[model samples]
Target chain A: MAYSIPTRQSTADIIFAQLRKEIMSLDLLPGTKLSEAEVAAKFGVSRQPVREALNLLSSESLVEIQPQKATRVGRFSMRRIEAARFARRAIEIEVLKNASENWSDVYAPSFARCLDAQRRAVAEQDTHSFQTLDEEFHALMADVAKAPFAFQQIKSHKSYIDRICALSLKDAAEMAVLVRDHEALLTHLAAQDATGAEAALRIHLSRIEKTIAAVHHANAEYFND
Target chain B: MAYSIPTRQSTADIIFAQLRKEIMSLDLLPGTKLSEAEVAAKFGVSRQPVREALNLLSSESLVEIQPQKATRVGRFSMRRIEAARFARRAIEIEVLKNASENWSDVYAPSFARCLDAQRRAVAEQDTHSFQTLDEEFHALMADVAKAPFAFQQIKSHKSYIDRICALSLKDAAEMAVLVRDHEALLTHLAAQDATGAEAALRIHLSRIEKTIAAVHHANAEYFND
Candidate 1:
């Protein structure tokens, strides 16, 4: 008979998402040991689901599972991080090109809303809220392009990047720079200048890449060390 | 204390890779339950490492984990498979464009080598071998553009498409059509015509998409039914 979608996801999926969000938000630190029994007890589920959830996280590279040893929250690898950032930049360039060619008025309000949320987050100086808003803004751009799946890939890649960015979350001034870039991109989108919009997006994406790298270098001890 | 820069990852990562290869190759059928203790016993490791490997598979969406229930080989989704095909086509068009602009003689041999491999695979009637070579051919194109990461995304998408393709492996004549398309793409890539190359790549991707969709419709029972 007909029923709700069943969340068809196992308890492991639920546990995995909860832990992943914690890891992504830095509620769980990198190098933190994720004991299966402990997690199982905490969630009041069997160690099996916790084990399954941890397995999923390991595949995402968000956790490290060592043989005969403990599984830990994943540490940052500068090289892998750089590679992901580069891929994101490359793919977004092509996406921006598509957006430029097919600019739409439908996405403007979404952009405005994300921008407004960003403004509110920054004005409040709440790092957590600002970062969340930042993700929404980038997602809005992808949605504006009418390719939500592409944005999903972008979000996954961004999630990898996000774990690291969270390490340097105290940079409020830099948030302003990102806000400016987003505004410029929104402007280009509004003007329907495909060429202009692409140029702005490239610059905007580059700023993010550069800032991320710089922060990583500045605090080398916080990463793969 | 140096040990070849740890070229070998942890056992969990290694097992995850091996299992992923098997699943992608369809040696592991959809809906097959993977027992942690059994797999661990087979790998001569503890359940801890095996659990981690399964987690990795789950993250890739290659395995399905049920909390306190069972972790099975991932089932195919027609919608996810379609999305992956579309994404691959979208990105490859841009990658082909990049290759055309920066066409080089250095990668010609590499390209031809993959093409020859595909030819050999076709002659031998080995669909599995042919698929690997097909992936290599697309990879070579991305290398020509000096953007190897582009192929990484393509492969990720290809995995989703391949799960569906596994069931539709009966049509030798249709396979022949796909081979011809690959040959045409190679011809255009060799000529360094950005416009022509992209057009060919788009045609190649679209054909596969159409074929795959047709197969999916005809065999809906094999999918997420």
Candidate 2:
């Protein structure tokens, strides 16, 4: 289901959203300490809102809050990272299968358009835009399959993967590979080859597995076994 | 990943967990209004903690919050229910496949024990226990497959489905059917029949689809299109 439009967000929500983005983008790197008073001052809000925001983030494992101890950005747990990958792969493969079965001329243009945007994003070295487009490309498959809700699980699990990917984004060559994989996946989908589409998707996702070690080594302090 | 053991919980966390259980169990039916002040009074705490709890629940879509308006238990959106079902089925089927392939003598007894618990729960007419056992049975499969993380997605999605199931617990006969399904699934797993296990799991999940129309009709006010 889609997020309900908030007519007016509470101060806590505003802070939570901002902090969540920062944490996910690694702007607030893992192991960074967060204090309610300091964060509240930075946001020009009271500590109450900041506390609430941290509490929410803690629930999602984005931050670790210890009783009577300083709160810190959560360490990257490999267990969680692996779990996220497994969940995303399972859900996306099913979504691709459905999209393949439902392939139609009507779905072709949108898929083509997303790939075009991906190429532009890569050429322009716009990692942020490319990341957004990457998500949209997969999400579009769910939409085309008439099961847009499948993207919720995909997005949820992707948060963990995205953080790791953010650390690996320096490899621009990977962007080209991702786009190529997407194109191959789309080709299979257009051909109504469910099995081929799943194979292509598996290859696309496996890139993350291959890069995990390098990313972890580069950001050693951020990870936990 | 497993939840970190909390050394101590704040007042807010305690209240939040309790309220979350109540909401998911359908004790707080859809459309029931919740007030920060009233909840605080009931819990003998300040309004701050209650407000925080509501915010957390809102994030989970367990409650609907509006500025300057009453927060209410979230309506059962058919779309969300369908999505949760789709996600859980996909993940569980995959987990069953793995469990079948990895079937060891050690895994058999646990499945058999869980099924025994299910039978006892049904015979005793303990719907709550039956529900818990039902979850455990599926979660056990993921554990057996060494894909324990899959249970996280399954449990997340099951929250939405459980609320719907709570309303249909009156049909004691359905519990028996669920146990039978589990028995057949365990038989397939014991035989190391991945395909058979997946087929049995599909049949088990499909029961929910068959009940949706009847449950929605019976609890008309709790659902939304």
Candidate 3:
């Protein structure tokens, strides 16, 4: 008890979070079966907490739990991925446009830090860590726009995108290209070039969408028809 | 089996659909405890169907489930509603702007129908039906944009917003102003007035924010603090 999993977080919270981290990091690949009994035994709890955790994850579209069926990591949906990408691209470009128009000097350092983390993630060849930082980088853009929650829709969409990326094991060069896109976006934002930022960000997301679809089709077995 | 419900749509579907309708209409108010035993009895089924129904609702953020405690209709949250509205506005306006750029003569009829329904809703003093039509009206914008999923996100967020509105009960006059705004938006979209439509839509969402906040304060008990 000297070193607990931090104070006051319920077993459900702990279970939900641990499972989410695994899902996001691709430690739990799409379509991976989530056995309630196994999860309960591993977490030193009963089936109820595991069920609740799975329910919460299901809300995030991270898991699929069916009545009288085994719980599993969620299936891939090309339509949904495409749909999420469209929404993310549309909204992100808008946010970039806003930040480009209203770039306060305050967000500059965090933006730089985000870029650097991606760089390090690449150098270390850590796709897992790189993906997390990639999310943070997008979040930093929302911060620059002073509309942090504006990215919530995109964030949800991004996880779906992440699932595809995880299954594909995208090339490091593509990751480098993404970093470059972020770099270009930062430059345009720094210069307050609203139209230019929008254009650049649009191109970036379009490329991601193309690559994502290719990845999905390449592993059609992993996807839901 | 004189008449059959599709297996894809089962008892769980019936219970979920019925409960969702009640919640949306505010016939089942926020904080109202949902006893599976009672709900099952009313539906002339066993508790298993009701339990699955509640789980489905819980995943959709329409019901609250507490471990070892009773489940209930979730309370409205000003924070969640405002957050939802922000997202709806952000996404819907972008789709509206897109629609203006590519005027779809096909969806014009749908848009007209939404307006016609709104008029009926007001005349009949059916706020609940009005809200459903309001959703269709916005979904029409996405149809016009060829970005149907954007409407999907808006629809997901609308449930949260509806819970707040059920508390506020904004007057019929308020509904009229929104209808007028929709008409203006429709006019602008028809004319392909991107800038004007975006401006009007922004103002429309801003008014919703103010009115919804006023209602939140006036009836604090209806929401989850």
Candidate 4:
């Protein structure tokens, strides 16, 4: 069920999407000050739409709105990142379990195609493409499980950890390990082994524990709490 | 791990919160046209804040914004609601399992107190308070499981079903059944029975299936899909 209605984006909507992508991809680092006037000038829109965009970001906790002061990209919090991982693990585990039980031969080709794309991404050392495919991998599991909204919720939680995950994905070795994990998960699903797939997913998601620690150790200033 | 930072609410934030509550409570029924000019006049603010509020609501799918046409409260979609329930169940079942395993005598009083409040709400015929306490019941389970973010995610999904749930809660008999389900769930948690508690939760959340069908039958015009 596609819940998205095809409505045209307002100026504010476009600005919000662009800023959200930048923030999530770490093109805009945490604690970076955002001036409404500057953003308006850059986007060639009035300050009203910029302010609206900032309000939207503030609601998502992507930015902090300090009245009478400046708005800054929200800093990372270890607590939030861990909490998000915990929540994502719960839903994705369920998704994997269902996908394993409901596995069919039809999905094997796409699963294998995605794996090949991941290998290519790692070989090319294209971190951005790897990250996008990584998301698509998990989303594919949700599709196999026929639980589209599970992936939507996972995406919502993913934002909290994207900065750290992006930093982790920069390492080619880490990308290789993730691809192997995805391969293992797909193998389990293809075999209709629910327990094996669930276990494989747990190991896959736990890679973040080390990544979070390494990312935070290297960039402590970007985080709060 | 309180992720919420206490920033002062802007005019738009206040209006957003108020309108969100109205929409979720079904006070501002589905398909009700919302006018920026009138809402601005009513709130004694410029249209910018009202538009911002509406935009925020639109982001949550609580409102549908048609650029040239009128913006109206979003009609309920059975597909989205079911998807929301599926996502909510996945996280919540895990929460209940953890709460059962981590059950301690210390939290029993609070759990019992919440159940008592639910009974009182039903007896007093206070559907609104009952709903609020029902949320608190789940939040308490999250605390017991030490998974606060899980409850936050559940609440996010809950908003997708709140309008229908609110309608269902209007019946005293239905409210009584829900209270009893809560009681059974609490009993299993108190006993530290993970399997039992998980089963109880599955039964508890499944009540929405019947409620959705009945609510949609009676209020067919309020739904889009």
Candidate 5:
């Protein structure tokens, strides 16, 4: 067994992480005003840390700060979501292309474990863990491609798409579909079929369009574009 | 002519921009110690703004800040450079493939104009302007691909690679070679030859390897890996 040392997080970092989670989870609804004083009081800290946290969230575009006015959770924009999807697809295609060529038997066990864990998450109706497993699955693919930084870049774009995903009404169904996509993607990679892998990955990613449409229909008021 | 309004910059933003330019241009050599008080005095500002500037640079990996110890310019790492290149190449290749399919006569005149300006920059041996033109050439290709955001992402990674390019000794000759490569890429795009365009881009970006080798020989002390 290995023990990992816990890294320190600044008060601001802690505040930012909590606020970001709330925002992404849609607990802090879009257009909801964020007050530094209230956040500071809730966190039992000074307003300085709250302001810093807000600034960090603003950089992520999760919050909008109007210098003299007020800060608020960001509203969904189709334009930003589309742009994020475009960049994500481009990088993932490249990663998949490489992964198909570099597929090794060494990674099979890890893939199997992740898939089994994903299935368990689906059965247990654990959407959050399922999301984590989905990310790990894609991340494992990046490892297979030997381009971890490529996934780092993908994660940056994913936050935008995730906002829409969070608005989704059916968690278990979506998780199951996503699991199936992963299974298909892995099968294509197992066969070392670059073309088939690319096609599978595309089909996997294109599911987001249906997600966006469904979420928009269900939560039209939350979107601005 | 259309008039565009200039956006305001905060004091910290200005300091960050100037320091980034100096570091990228090799005026501030890698691993050079940076003092908050000294930089404040140099920029005719207070330590607060200087600290903010250093924080911004730290985010870009252009500087390293050790809390309560010292801050210094980031040293070159072949690992980081290669990672940046891999991401850049993947995105650029996707952009080129799109451009090859979406080529239009309307963009031809712009390409010709950019190529001519690049040539003029080479004739005058103006490395700064030449670098700007090179970015513009790439940006235009992204526009042709109808994926301007892709280029935005590429520019983020290009800063990492620019450090090495700044170290190259042959300014004019390098500019000439890059300009020629841009011309070849444009020719391939005009012919709607995706394979040729991708090949040309690979050849163009591969020049960085030679630049890296030459710079490593000249400035071995500035590198870490």
Candidate 6:
């Protein structure tokens, strides 16, 4: 989905969303200080809302708050990253298995639509759009399986993975590989082959392992050991 | 784990924790109005922190905030409860499978200790302690599997299940069944039987479906359809 600016959120909600996006997209890099006073001034709000926003972010582990010290964008936590990967893999595999069992002709069109959008994104070299479509593809799987909540967990755990993917997307070949993985997964699902679909998904998700290593080597300073 | 009152928390943090406990324990019953002025006065803090705390709770779906309307303890959301259940079941089953594979002699003592504590809680008729121990049992499984993050997801999705469980715990027989389920699960784990452990865990988690029904029947007002 395209990131539409929220129009009707509370001041604190707006600040939280903006800061969360910046942090997840790595615009506010790890270890970057977030001054409450400066953020308040920049958002044209008081420190109360700014502090509230920071507290919200801290809860998500996107920002670290130290008592009597400055708040900073959280360093990439390898443990949390691994946890996210594990949770995503487990949930998506389960979802794919369910989708494979319940596969119908109606689901094929949705998969094709997402793949078509993804192919366009690849040709345009729009990594941002590709990333959004990538999420949509997985979300469609969960939707087909009637397990929308699985997508919520995946989305929650995906921030870390997405940030790493953001860095890895500079390699155009990576996007092509992702599109191919989606095709393979769709083929398996179309055949109602749960085992094959799961295998395809395992390979699809494993791409992140290599991406994590590549991203970490290039941006070691952003990570926590 | 013992619910240690946080000693080194900010004003907002303290309020959030206090309100969260009250809400989760059903001390602050669903639909109870939470006025900012009243809460601030009750806590002897300013409204700023109170608003922040409410915002925090809102994020967790423990409180509901509507623009230009008073905030209140959220009505128990069945959809959210089901979502939590689905996520918890998927993650825990995966954790159990992993724990079964990595089962070692060293892991038996931890499960036994938790079971021992659970037995004590049941005998003493301390449902609260039983609840805590129940969480410890599952967390220990995740810990043994070397997937601590899985426990985090479980914990995060558990608050809804937990609140429902707290309501259901008035039935003494229910607690006995839970302890028995733990014993059964532990037996499978000790035997390193992954499939058997998964089956045990599934049955263990399925207890909540009945509890949800019973709790809703007894306390219909607390729930939303």
Clashes of each: 4, 0, 0, 0, 0, 0
Candidate number achieving the greatest lDDT relative to the actual structure: 4
Tens digit of per-residue lDDT, candidate 1, span A1-225: 778675667677789889988998889988888999989999999998887777768767889987568999988887677557655665565566666667778777788888888887777787788877877877666666656666777777778987776666566677778888989877877776766876787677666666577777886755784
Query: What fraction of native interface contacts does model 4 preserve?
Result: 0.72
- Arrange candidates, best TM-score first: 2, 4, 6, 5, 3, 1
Which segments of model 6 are wrong by more than 4 Å? Answer: A1-7, B1-7, B120-126
RMSD (CA, Å), candidate 2 to true, equals 2.9
Residue B44's lDDT in candidate 6: 96
Off by over 4 Å in 3: A1-73, A97-102, B1-5, B8-19, B32-73, B120-129
List TM-score per model, in order.
0.77, 0.92, 0.81, 0.91, 0.90, 0.91
Q: Each candidate's chain A: what TM-score? A: 0.83, 0.92, 0.82, 0.90, 0.90, 0.92
DockQ of each: 0.36, 0.65, 0.40, 0.64, 0.54, 0.67
- Residues A1-225, model 6: lDDT tens digits: 968665367788789989998988778888999989999999899998889889989988889987788999988878888888888888887788788888899988888999999999889899888888998999999988888888988898887678766665555677899899999999999899988998898899887787788888999998887
TM-score of 2: 0.92
Q: Which runs of model 1 end up more than 4 angstroms from their true locations?
A: A1-18, A32-50, A90-103, A120-127, A170-173, A187-195, B1-58, B63-73, B90-103, B123-126, B147-150, B170-196
- Higher-scoring candidate on TM-score, 1 or 3: 3
Q: Residue-wise lDDT of candidate 4 within A1-225, one digit each (tens)?
A: 878878777898899999999998899998999999999999999999899889889888899988989999998887788678878888898888788878899998898899999999999999889988999998999999988888988998886887666766467888899999999998889998987987888898887787789889988898886
lDDT values for all models: 0.75, 0.87, 0.81, 0.87, 0.86, 0.86
Error of 6 at A166 (Å): 2.3
How would you class the docking of model 5? medium
Determine which window of 10 residues in candidate 4 chain B has minimal summed lDDT. B162-171
What tens digits encode model 6's per-residue C-alpha lDDT throughout B73-169? 9988788887888878878878988898888998778888889999989899898788789889989999988898788888988877877767764
- Per-residue lDDT for A55 in model 5? 68
lDDT score, candidate 4:
0.87
lDDT of 1 by residue, B24-139 (tens): 87888888889998888888989887787887677678889886789999887765765576567766876787787778777778877777776677777788788777788788
TM-score of chain B of 2: 0.91
Give all candidate RMSDs, comma-separated.
4.6, 2.9, 4.4, 3.0, 3.0, 3.7
lDDT of 5 by residue, A1-225 (tens): 757445467787799899999998889999999989989999999987787678667767888886567888988877778778887887898899889999999999999999999999999998888889889999999999999888888898897888778776657888798899999999999999887988888888998888798888888787786
The TM-score leader among the candidates is: 2
What's the lDDT for residue B61 in model 1?
Answer: 81
A92 Cα displacement, candidate 4 (Å):
0.9
